[model samples]
Target: MNNTVPEDGEQLRAAVRERYSRSVGPLLANQPNSANSCCSSDCCTPPSTQDVRDTTSTDCCSTDCCSTSQADPITGDLYNAAELGTLPIAAVLASRGCGNPTALAELKEGEKVLDLGSGGGIDVLLSARRVGPGGFAYGLDMTDDMLAIAERNRQEAGIQNVQFLKGIIEDIPLPNDSIDVIISNCVINLAADKGQVLREAQRVLVPGGRFAVSDIIFQGQIPPALRSDLESWAGCIAGALEENVYRQLLQQAGFTDIEVEVTRRYTLEEIAAGGARASIAVLNEEERRQTEGKFVSAFIRARKPAKQV
Candidate 1:
């Protein structure tokens, strides 16, 4: 994967915003039987932005605003039956996560948690349940449509300790050192400025706070053509960082104990997109093969220093 994110920041943002906005129909419609990912032909859903999202839960889907890939390579089987059973079908369906950050985060009974790019509030609601009444969970997302879906799901779930905020991950609205733990689900990789995002995450967490997230990262080389494709970026595949770069960024952001553990490798066939006009079309069979083992889902962990230097 490339080290630099797409330079056209506004275009990237617009690509993301448009994709998620169209998803409003199926998301709020509360369609029965949840899809594995937000925008998949598997479930006949529209373009996805899981977490409202930073993508691909979403580092969410869509290489084209109206088109989608053949499989949800980054989403699926992250949530357990117990977790799924506890949430609304829409919330479960709207989930755009690469991993269950809440489960891996090991949230305590009284911890303030923040979910950057908290799409439909799945992690937020779950965190509220874990943190209990004394603690709180805040879900931040840039898409109002996704926020509406989150709010609807929140009301349906009847969980009181959670609030969904409207904002992007790069510029979190909360005060500095105001949070206990920071979590994101496959969303950070979607940001055009991942450095700023990590910095903001660092800024908001209390000293000694934790950073646990599920995201898509690369282990090896990515085609230069793919890196330049803005649509692939919107779909989550184009914008991810190599694992080493991810660790370096965290360290530069004043984090310690950083770790990037791969959970799954996306096979070549799984990355196929049926849509003729989809963004992944840039990758022919050879390009797809080159990408086979390079792309992976990872659980990244880091902690802010006990005292900032």
Candidate 2:
């Protein structure tokens, strides 16, 4: 609940890790039909920025994006009932992603795949099925609780083609040119250094490997005052890159044919109604006006071209 943003990379990483680790318990306890209730009518209204400035800590996730209970609208609707039927209920409950990367990754049989920030292994399990027995899927996550749950889900599913590794997305553990496809679900925006994450992704991919992910992107400029708040970063708001900047980052990472397709656009009203309401509610009327219709969840696609002869 600390209001101040972490000043250094290590601090930022620790804060994010702590937040996600704490979220696991609530996610497990959430019911199938539950929606994010963090900012519902029953909850208390958000305090003004000046009032919060005097407070020592603020639960940014509960107030903003960290809460992933059944009430969380952002994590739901990404999976179909048929897909949900194939995995443990716990896996489906643990999903905190914004999009279904496996559905769009175009995974082929016998292709090796990697998922960055593979929270509860839902996408990994789905990818394993798509790749069949001849292929393998690897999931990388930094949180021990999430990894444990993911492994438990993997066991429950009785799948043999998937393995979950412990690591940060910015510094992937895999070797270079070893993977055919890289996918992530709403995780890159959480990284302290997105450029490094992209670079690591590029380094691990074999030439011709595809980069497919779902993430939050901004279409217009966020108010400078809003952009500087670290609390918003942890909530998946402050960290989102502008659409063009996202493309340039991919280009800089040696990716070709970058495409960002919007899957869901968030309005200020929608945010105000969701788990992140407390965060958005703190904005003044003018700031609220600036943010409307600017943020979107997108499916980003790019490719590492074939190696030169």
Candidate 3:
């Protein structure tokens, strides 16, 4: 994995798009089914934590590849067993979210919800069920393969009130003040311009609408070298803003009652155990120690103030 961040805006966006596009192919091929056939005859069974540490040659940043082992602790055990059973098998298998936003978003009946970076439509399907037939759900994603899979999952689940749109999170395609609630799962940290993403979220939300998401957040400063790594950025590390900075950005984007609640914190030992050794491989022992307890998966909540008369 390349360790250097792309300095050019367009270049960075292209890099992210290409990485995700390549990952979707393998993920789609590996979707679990009744036959339980492997993606390939030579496919190794799902890897364990030790297996991930032993295999240092693979690109640990590739979501499709590394996630097959379930070594990335950030993405697992988010939804409960019953919740997983309710969605299409493909949706359940394709989910890569860090947290269960649908569970925490407190969705209500007859509400209109939009999911940013709605990979595989897991949250959208879940949200659709929560909001019921009287409500609607919209999923927006930039990757064609993910969108395709999400749409297929929606059809398979026989859901009628959900729609998927292709677009970047920084520039939502919805009209202003159109959404009742906005939700996302671990996808915001992948954006190169988070402030813009928040602004767009605020723009499309109705006054008093809620902003609820599960995302990576940092508590302390990360070394500049780590922050500049392209792999770290793609893996939801380098792009994570410190908790205070994250809250400030939300306030700057015109959101109020900003609250960032920590859901899970990652220790350095856990990182090495979780198949992200590549991210820490460059760090010296002391630098690695500095990272302990600094990174967290947070449930961020904020609101767009009600419209004034």
lDDT of 2 by residue, 192-240 (tens): 8899999999999999999999998888877664455555665666677
Better candidate number, 1 or 3, judged by TM-score: 3
Candidate 3: stretches off by over 4 Å? 30-71, 272-275
Model 1: residues with Cα > 4 Å off, grouped in runs: 1-6, 32-41, 44-71, 273-289
Which lDDT value does model 1 have at 300? 97
lDDT of 3: 0.77
Instruction: State in Å the error of residue 202, model 3.
Output: 0.5
Decoy 1 TM-score against native: 0.83
lDDT of 1: 0.74
Candidate 2 TM-score to native: 0.84
Q: Model 3 over residues 226-251: C-alpha lDDT tens digits?
A: 68877667667777888888999999
TM-score per candidate, chains pooled? 0.83, 0.84, 0.85
What ranking emerges by lDDT with the best candidate at the front? 3, 2, 1
Local accuracy by lDDT, each model: 0.74, 0.76, 0.77
